[model samples]
Target: MTLLKTPLLDTIREPADVRRLPQEKLAQLAAELRAETIDAVSVTGGHLGAGLGVVELTVALHHVFNTPHDRLIWDVGHQCYPHKILTGRRERIRTLRTGGGLSGFTNRAESEYDPFGAGHSSTSISAGLGMAVARDLGGGERNVVAVIGDGAMSAGMAYEAMNNAGAMDSRLIVILNDNDMSIAPPTGAMSAYLARLISGQTYRSLREIGKQIAGHLPKFVERGAQRAEEFARGFWTGGTLFEELGFYYVGPIDGHNLDHLLPVLKNVRDAKTGPILVHVVTQKGKGYGPAEQSADKYHGVVKFDVVTGAQVKAKSNAPSYTRVFAESLISEARRDPKIVAITAAMPSGTGIDLFGQAYPDRTFDVGIAEQHAVTFAGGLAAEGFKPFCALYSTFLQRAYDQVIHDVALQGLPVRFIVDRAGLVGADGATHAGAYDLAYLGCLPGMVLMSPADEAELMHMIATAVAYDDGPSAVRFPRGEGVGVERPDRAEALPIGKGRMVRGTGEGDVAILSLGTRLAAALEAAERLEAAGFAVTVADARFAKPIDRDLALKLASGHSALVTVEEGSIGGFGSQVLQFLTDEGVLDRGTVKVRSMVLPDIYIDHDTQARQIAEAGLDANAIVAKVEGLLGKAKAGRELSRAG
Candidate 1:
C-alpha cells in the first residue's frame, strides 16, 4: 500500500498549531486530515464514514476554539478519529481499536482534549451542559461545544438534556451534524448568510436591547413584537423550536465548507447567548468515493483496500451467532405468525435486518431508544403478539427499568435475543457483554439462558419462543460459533435442565459450564482426564433457576467442583454456590468449589481469545485451576493419614 503524503498534517502537533495556521491553508489541512483518517482506519478497521464526514468540522472546531481549555465534546465518539489526529495523537492513530492503542472512541484518560469519554450516543448535550454550568460557577469563560449526529437525536436523552439546558439558560453550544438529511432541509448560501448574521454579536446585542425595550412597553405589544421576530426568522431558518426552548438557533449551514464554519463558529463564540444551537449539514463519507457512494456499507469496516475499498474478512468455518439467531427467529416466525422482531436503532447490528428482509411488516426499528423498545415489546406481548426484542447485551443495560417494570414484573412473554454476550474483540470494555448474566439472572421469574454453540443457539431461540409463561432471554457471544453441526430442525429444550457433555461416571473433579465457555470446559476436562484425574463436564443451559438436580449431584459426587461462565462474578457461578449452600452441600467441606468468571478489571480491546485467556476462562487456565485444586485435595488426604 502506498502511503499518502500529509505535508500539511505532518506540521501540526496540537490544536494550537492548527489555530496558528493561515486560514487559506486550512482547506488543504482538512483534505490532508481526511486522507490521514482514511489511511489510519484502513490499517486498523473501525468507524470510517462518521470520521470522514466530520473531517472539516473537526478542523474548524479546533481551529476556532482553544481545546483542552475550551470544552469540546463529541457525541458517540466514533467520529473522533479526525479530532484525535489534531490533538497530539496522530502518531498512534494507526493502532486504533487494537490492544494498548488509541481507542475507537473519545476517551478521557487517553488525552486532555477528550474531557468526557463516550461510547454510547446522545450523551454529549448532558455532559456539555454540566461543563458549561461548572465553568459559570467557577467564574471562568470557556466555550462548551457539543457535536452530535442527527441520528443520535432520535434518543430521548438528547431532548431531556436540551429541555434542562434551555430552562437553565446555560451558555452551551450544540452543533447538530445533520448528515442523513433527516432533521432539516438542505443548506445553501442564503441559510449560511442568515446563520452568520443571527449568530453575530451585533445581531444578538440588538435583539437583547429590543427585548429590554419591549419589557418596558405594554404587555400585549411586547408579546406581538416577540412573536413577529420569531416568526420572521423561524419562517426562513426553521429555528422556532429551538427559540421556543430558549436557545438562539443558527444554521443548517454547509459543514464541509471551512469558510462558512469558521465565521459562524467565531460569531457564536463571541455572543453572550445563554444557550445556542448550530445546525451544520454534511454528507457521510463526504470526500471518499467508495464511502460516499454507499455510506452505510462503509460506516464500519474491516481492514480494507484504501483504493479499491474492499474489506478483508476472515473466513469462518461456522456461521456467526447473530446470523444463527436471525435465521432461527425467521424460521419460527414463519410458523408462528404472532412472532415479531424489534431493534433499537441497530437493525443490522442485532441481525434484525435479515428478519426485516423476510418479514418487513413484523420487524420494527425503534431508533436509538432502548427503553422505549422494551416497553413497546411489553405492549405487544400484552396484545397477544410475541415480540422478540433483539438487542446487544451491553445496550440492554439502558432499558433495565422497562425490562423489570413493564416486562419481567408483569410476566410479559417478551423474548429478549441478547446478542454479543461476552467480551467483544475490537470494541473493548465499553461494548463487552459481560454483565447481562448478572443483571438478568437476579430478576424474579426471569428465565435466562446462554448457548454453547450455533446448534444450542437455535434450540435456545426455539425454547425462548415456546416458553410463553414469562420474560426469557438468551445471550450468545459475538463472532463465529464453534463449528458444531446445526440441527436440521431446532427443537425446544426442557427448561432448567442440564445435559452432561462428557464423563457421566463419578470423577475426582467436575466442571459445570454455562454459555460458550462450555467448549473451554470440555477441553479442560480432556486434559484433566489425561493427567489421570477423572473429570465430568456438564453444560448448565440456564443461569436463572439453575438445574438444582445437576448442581447437587455434581457437588456431592465429586471431590472438587469448578464452575465456568463468560460473564461477571455474580452470575451463573454465584447462583450455583448459593443453591449448594442452601442445600447443605457445602457444610461438610467435603468438596472444593471454585467459580471462574471475568476478572474484576475491565479488559481492553484485543482478540477475543487473548481476552478470555487473560480473564482465566480459557482451556489452559481451566486445566491449571483443576491441577491446583486436586493437588490441595491430595495434600489434605496426606495430612489425614499422618494425623
Candidate 2:
C-alpha cells in the first residue's frame, strides 16, 4: 500500500540493481516507480500522463529483457520518463527538462539504456529494424523491441517500416501502445478502428484461450496447426492490416497488468520468428487521479501542486505567440470562406484548434502525418482553397520532400504557418526549429519570413494570404509575444523587404537580424552604442530573397557588417554572407563581416533565453563578438595609417 517507501524501489540505483531483486517484488516495484514518476514530474514540469501510463509496461520490458545489449527503442520518447527512472536516472528525475538537467525525451548520449534516441513519432520500428539487421549481420542473438504508440502508427513511415520488416523477416518486436490519443483526441479512421479492436474484451479473452489451446498440442500437431492457428488469430485479433504487412499480430492485452505483460513479452521474446506486433491497451494517465481525468492537460505540464494537481501559472503581459496566431487565423477564416486550416495531429499545440472551432467543416486534423498534411494542402490549393498548413518547425522536417515536390515545384500558393520557429524550450534539441529557415529558403519559389514581434507576425500572416505565387512560410517563436500592441487591421507587408529598427545613418557595424532574436540584437547594438560604436540594426523580414538591395546598401556604407539570427549558421545570416560574396563586396571593400548563429550541436531543454545564451546568441555574447570585430577593424586601419 505504501508504494513510495518500498525497499525494492529504494534499493534500485540502476536497471542492474533491479535485475538483482526477486521477481515477486516486481509488482511493488512498479507501484513505487509510478509514485516516483508522479512526484518527479510535479517538480520538474514535463510529460506526466504518458509516463504514468507506461509504468507497468516499462518495468515488465526491462525485467523480461536484457537492455543496453538487447536494445529497446522508444518511439516519440515523451513516454520515456518511467523508462528513464527505471534505467539509472531515478536520482536525477527532479532535474528533468530544465537547463543543464536531464532531457525530457530519450537521448542516446544520456544513457546506454536508450539504444535509439527519438523525439519524433513513428521512428521506433525503423530504428529497431536497423538494430535487428546489425545484430543479425554480427551473428549476435539479442531481442530488439520498438515500442510505438497507435498515434504514431498513423504516419506513413510506420507502415514503410512494417512493410520492409515483413519482407526481410527480421526478428523485430513492435509494441503498439493503443491509448486512442496523441496530444489531443485521436484523428482519422485508423485511430477509431484501433480503439475498437483494442478495447474489445471478448476478442482479447478468446485470443488468450486460443493461445493456451495451441500450447497444449503435440509438436507434430502444432506443425500441422499453422493454418488453423492463423485462422483463429485472424478471427480473434482482427489485425489484417499488420498481418498483411507480414507481422505476427498478437494481443489487445491490458498493458497495465504486469502479470499479463511479463508472460506475453516472455512468450514473444522466445518465439524466434519474423516481425511481431503486440497491441497493448493502456490508459494515457493510469493511476493518478488528475492525470487520468484529463490526460491532455497533464501531457506536458508546468510545475504543479502535487496535492491539488493545479499548475502554478506564470503571469504574462501578452498572449502566447501560438494564441495570437490562432486568433488571427480564426479571424481570417471567418472573413474568407475559401480559407481552411490543417495540422498533423498538433491542433492545440499549433493553435489550429481555434481555426478548427471556427471553420469546423474546412479544418483537417491529419493524425501525426506531416507528409500527408503537406501534400493534402497542395491538393486543397489546386482546388482554389487557401490552405494554411500549420505545423511546428521541427515536425515540418517530416514533410520537406512534399513541400518541394508537391507545393514548391508546382508553385502552389499554400501558406505554411510555422509555429515554434526558434529554440523551443523544454522539448530540447529534438524539437528546436533551428534548420527551417535554411531548409525552406533553399526551395525555389518558396518565400520564407520570420516576424520580429506579434504585430509583425500578423502582418506576415496577411502577406502570406495575399501572395498567390508559390509556397510561403511565416515562422514565429514559442511562448508569450513581446508586449507590443497588436494592430486592429492586419495589413500586407511588402514582400522581400527589410525594416530598419534602429540607427538612421551609416555606422561602423550594421546588424542584420531575423526572427524574435532581433530584439536581442537591438539591445546588443544599444550596448555597443554606449561604448561609442554606432551600430545600425535591421530586421530582415524575408530570408529567401535576402533583401539584397537593403543588405548591399547597409554593407556598402558600414565599416563592418554583422548578421544575427536565432537559427543555425546556415540560416538567414548565411544568406546575407552569401549575398555579400556574390556581390563581390568582400573583395572590393574593407568591410569586416561577422555572423551570429546557433551552435551546431543540439541544445537541451530550458527557457528560450537560457538556450539562446548557451548557443552564444544572447545580447551580451553578440555585443562582445561585435566589439572584438570592431576592435580588429580599427586596428587594421591604424596599421594601414602607420604604414
In candidate 1, stretches whose alpha carbon ends up further than 4 angstroms from where it belongs are: 632-643
| TM-scores, all models, native as reference | 0.97, 0.90
lDDT of each: 0.91, 0.84
Q: Please identify model 2 stretches exceeding 4 Å from their true place.
A: 1-4, 20-23, 181-231, 632-643
Report the lDDT tens digits of candidate 1 across residue range 271-356. Answer: 77688999898899989999999998889999999889999999989999999999999999989999999999899898999999
Q: Residue by residue across 386-441, what tens digits does model 2's lDDT show?
A: 99999999999989999999999999999998988889888998999888988898
Pairs that collide, model 1: none
lDDT of 2 at 639: 67
